[model samples]
Target chain A: MALIEVEKHEVEEEQKPEPVRVRGLPFFPHFLLREVVVMCLIAGGLIMLASIYPAGLLKPADPFDTPSPIYPEWYFLYVFGFLKFWTWDLGPIPAKMIGVTVPMVLWYGLLILVPFIDRNPSSDIRKRKVAVTLGVIVLIGILYFTYFSIVHH
Target chain B: MTLNDKIYKWLDDRFKLSELLPPIVKHPAPLNVVSNPLYCLGGTAFLCFLILVITGIFLAMYYKPTPAEAYKSVEHIMTAVPMGSLIRSVHHWAANTMIAAVMLHMMRIYFMGAYKKPRELNWVVGISLLLITTTFGFSGYLLPWDQLAFWATKIGTGIAGSIPVIGGYISLILVGGNDIGAETLTRFFAIHVMILPIAIATLLGLHFMMVRIQGISGRL
Candidate 1:
């Protein structure tokens, strides 16, 4: 009876304190003040950039004339880069299919599956060696592909 | 009593403001999160979004979706409309900045393993946000209907159309016919203006709500 009562007390103790409710600055004034300042700086920088380098307008669209070295937006360069890089057919599948699927579908699928895949409960960087290394590799691959698309364009 | 006190008393009687306001007003943002510059990326993206929304509305007030008038309308916005150049230029820069900020924010989240345990769903919503933001870029790219926009979209649609089984359908749905024409322009305009904004707004609400529920994973 005493052992059971002790276990119940221990369970109550574990549940009593909320782990994440650490004391910090109030959100309204202290935190929001910093946010507003940062926001102003960014807003100013954007306006300056806009004034210095206005957005360009090119010649009207002509269906008969296709421009050379056409490219998608900068964010999408990787898709084009991967398409160019992967020219091999895996058995019956075509190269284009592989190229499109790998980057567009497989990459995003892996990203969405990250939390589930890692299964490592630790948030500490020092403890997550494999996750950090893989993340670096993926980042490098994306950067390289983006660079590839630009240079090859 | 002061006028402010009278107003508060009135509001508190009807809406229970006194009960609701204290907890929210006293909520603490983690000290590290407030000090760290890296934590600012998401807010940066959000600020860009707000800027884009304002400028985009101004541009849309003058923009015409038809291919015949699309480029001309954009030209008008740039050269003719009052402060049009600044608005369009700001929109352009904000869109680009938002994309970069979102990417950096995702990297921060990934490195910190902030998506672990109870926050996995928020990560999913975030990836969806990233996808929506890029789609915003893609759909908006073709709005000006210039040589670059047209050809770039052509290349983009061609790539999207090459996906094995459903590629043809996706292409057809996007293009609206055998070729990119008036239909394509109008469709993209609708998507850029209507569909994406609604989708993004909804997802952003969910994303923030989740964050509030889970708190900032501010460790490391």
Candidate 2:
């Protein structure tokens, strides 16, 4: 997200910009074709090897054979794990108040006004200490709580 | 302007690109978010969307998007289609990647203070887009109709059921009954395919406009 500004910042390979001598010969940038090709080949080769001598292994999924440890993907694990840790076991009203409805309402409501909340006009990492701090805290909280769920549970 | 014609001409004369780029950028102020942070994230998300649609269409050629046929179709794709397993894996990996990418994109906006000032509404819309994306992922879980699909969705919809006054009704609406069955499958399918897509597209349009109006915020 604009780590280096394109408009003003000269993100040359080196620390300083090398002068562009206007040589008319069209020199295209070197494409990383070799690495890309090798990766594709490796993936394809592995898949092909598996195809040649198939184990033919597949168990018919039974309706009743519900597997344990039914976790969401690594992503939703944050939310899934959150749900497990913070079940608002306060019946219908409180559950609704804390869980589904409030979370949505608060998140959306807060988001709608974040611009006002952190009224700093700078996206500069140096200037916007408050925003950056908040960002780090949120990121840490998500990862930390998610870790707790996996480790403790 | 037609991109093919513009691009072919531009490649013929890129030295003049700066002039051409701005003249182009200056057009359609709000919603035309070119040359910005929003544009960068939007472009990446677009790329991910392209990956998903193309891979999903390929997957759908063999995918049975129902309970009984879902697992078999996935198996057939893995075993029967040429390089099907790799394709499926790529699709799986790509979906997870897209979610992460979008989340990071949102975080980038959040931290950068791009969500402030004239872009507040857009930020809210962006959050809604985040929710929709996760919803898309959640509904998609059930497409396989495997054990993962069954209980995960059950739990997900159960969360919906936890809402106070209308919790039970919401769960009923989501699951289509006391249990997850055909109705639930069809409902989730409609969301994954139809409703969520439309909502995302609409929000994306608005987000792009707001970004264009606001331009890119700076790091300093």
Candidate 3:
């Protein structure tokens, strides 16, 4: 009976919340100070880069003379890769729907559904193995496809 | 009284600046957030956006929306205007940086599990913001009216044109006609400079308001 009481007490102690630690300096000076310094550094770096390598202005566009293998900006390369990779003998409508519409919808849908789907309240990454694994896999896939588009194009 | 104190009192009496400023100026950030560098990505993105706006305004002063003059205007800016190339390059780099920063910020939020429970709406808003930002890039890409800009936009709109039933309409709306031409350039210019800025600013305000109300998410 005594041992049971002792065990119950220990469990209650474990369940108690830890005291919150307020460790940082006040926002007015400390945080702002750091932010200002970082901003100045970024500005300096940008100015230096801009001076060193000014953006090149390409020739005027001619509708009659089309460029071969036109590609979108770097960020859109993954989408470009998707369109290339999914080129089976599927009809135009089916190809567009399946290759373009479906993947885009699914990607955004997954993003929207994340909070609802992962109900586990813990923020510790290790505790949420499935979420972490999926996130890493998606990241990897994006990078791989992006690389492929760049090299192949 | 000191000169500074006298000026402050004068402004405070007229505008009630003293009463309105404290809450914002003295707002407390969580200690962990202060110490962590990852939390700064959103602020950096905001900074980049500010840079883009300033530089974009300067470029717009010289830029022409017409298909015939668009490329020439850009070239003129680079060659004739004072520090024009530098400003344009900075705008280009900043846009790229802002996109990167926003992406990193989103990844950080995801990994930290900051989008749970009451913060879900903020996540949705954030995703919308990302799409808007990308749209900003896409619209702006056509403004130079160069070979790359023309062809890339043609391909981009072509992708939209491939959508089943409404694809044709969507492409028409995007390009403002059958092909990428004067209409397309003008439409993209309008969206880039006017529509997108207003939309992004409004969404940013809402996102920040939510963050301020909810406070930063705690670590596990």
The lDDT values for all models are 0.91, 0.65, 0.84
TM-score of each: 0.94, 0.70, 0.90
lDDT of 2 by residue, B41-132 (tens): 54555556656677767877887666677778878887789978766665565566568778888877776667777777888888788788
Clashing pairs in 1: none
Error of 1 at B86 (Å): 0.5
Query: For each candidate, what's the DockQ?
Result: 0.50, 0.22, 0.36
* lDDT of each residue in A1-106, candidate 2, tens digit only: 1111112345677678654432111111111232235345544543454455432223444557766666666666655555555666666445434645544445
User: What is the TM-score of model 1 when looking only at chain B?
Assistant: 0.97
RMSD of 1: 5.8
> Per-residue alpha-carbon lDDT of model 3 for B83-140, expressed as tens digits?
8999999998888888989999999999888998889999999998988888899998
- On lDDT, the stronger of 1 and 2 is 1
Give candidate 2 misplaced runs (Cα > 4 Å). A1-63, A87-105, A122-127, B1-22, B25-42
Number of the candidate with higher DockQ, 1 or 2:
1
- Considering only N, C-alpha and C atoms within 3 Å, which residue pairs clash in candidate 2? A96-B164, A115-B116, A124-B219, A124-B220, B31-B209
Let me know the TM-score candidate 3 reaches against the reference structure: 0.90
Please tell me which predicted candidate would have the highest lDDT against the true structure.
1
What is model 2's C-alpha RMSD?
8.8
Taking every candidate in turn, the Cα RMSD to the unseen true structure, in Å, is 5.8, 8.8, 7.1
TM-score of chain B of 2: 0.79
